[model samples]
Target: MTGQGSHPRHGLVDVIHAPVRLSIVAALAGLEKAEFRFLRDTIEVSDSLLSKHLTTLEAAGYVQIVKAGTGRRPRTWVSLTPAGRTAFDAYTESLKKIIDAGN
Candidate 1:
């Protein structure tokens, strides 16, 4: 698990391993989706930084981003993909296994 190393095989999602990315994933785990402003504020990350992380997550097919609104500018909404939820679930399980290994 996440004890002394990191990797998918080690129960860690590399793309989501960074502190910020991990926090992003964790934050999105409980919601159907979160708006950009809400996520930025909650994660305490700058717009650029959050954009970068979102891009990474999107590239991995772990997150879905959509734009919608009734104006010239559309609001951004992001949520975990099915694959993402599955991955997160597996990661948590693996982490638990590691903790239980010595018990």
Candidate 2:
């Protein structure tokens, strides 16, 4: 019998557990950086919703948000941090373990 009592899913990072946040992380994982509007469109969330989730991910050190451009047009960019990538890798491994457990 296993000594550990907790499920592998318990190892999931709470910050990235939410659907929207998870989507954000997953999307960022494949790209060096993406514009905020592109992410919002890809994730199918409103600007405010994306901003809210980005704030949470930023607070958790899982994402970096940058604002650029000048004049009438400014752009926001988002990317996963090194720490975020590490955490996401671990989270996916935990999910794999969970799937294996069910098999």
Candidate 3:
């Protein structure tokens, strides 16, 4: 058994554990890709906050990013990579396991 105060962990994913990132992954999982504004609005976070989380997920290889300019405006799009999908699936399973353990 783990020491007191140390929580039992099985397949928990730390990166996606953050509420915003989890939402980001969940939103992207259902779509091929999503625009920055769409994700920002869907996640209900400020632009900077969304960008920060994207950067973190991108660094972790959980998301793919592409930037382009439409007319005079630059647009950013993000999608879950194959790795991201796998990680998200694992995260879901882990969360389920945690919940089931308490039952």
Candidate 4:
């Protein structure tokens, strides 16, 4: 994709581009792994909103969700996959280059 200037823009994988998803990924990058509620709170999104973003990330192979326990209060943990880390790094680098060009 192309931006307003001459810079080529990066495309969001099935996982990273959405605002909520991007926030989720950024938060996950800072933690070893995060619980569902932690991510929901960190991203300041509703439970349903977080869940939807997580589902998309999971489907895109960018994140993995582990479900523990078998009852009503099962704990769900989310982590970024190697693919996700690489994608996030690439996105940040691309942004940096764009910023540097304007300097």
Candidate 2 residue pairs in clash (backbone atoms < 3 Å) = none
- TM, every model: 0.83, 0.92, 0.88, 0.84
Off by over 4 Å in 2: 1-4
1 against 4, candidate with superior lDDT: 1
lDDT by residue for model 3 over 12-97, one digit each (tens)? 67999999999999999999999999999998999999999999999999999999999899999999999999999989887777
Using lDDT, give the best candidate's number. Answer: 2
Identify the runs in model 3 with alpha carbons over 4 angstroms from their true place. 1-8
Q: Against the correct fold, how does model 2 do in TM-score?
A: 0.92
Query: At residue 8, what lDDT does model 3 achieve?
Result: 34
lDDT (C-alpha) at residue 102 in model 1: 59
**lDDT at residue 57 of model 3 (Cα atoms):** 97
lDDT of 1 by residue, 1-103 (tens): 4366653347766887788888888899999999998999998999999999999999999999998995887799999999988888887787778777758
RMSD of 4: 3.3
lDDT of 4 by residue, 1-103 (tens): 3444446354334357678888999999888899998888877989888988888988888889998976778989999999888888887777777778689
In angstroms, give how far residue 58 of model 2 lies from its true place. 0.1
Q: Each model's C-alpha lDDT? A: 0.87, 0.95, 0.91, 0.82
Each model's number of backbone clashes?
Answer: 0, 0, 0, 0
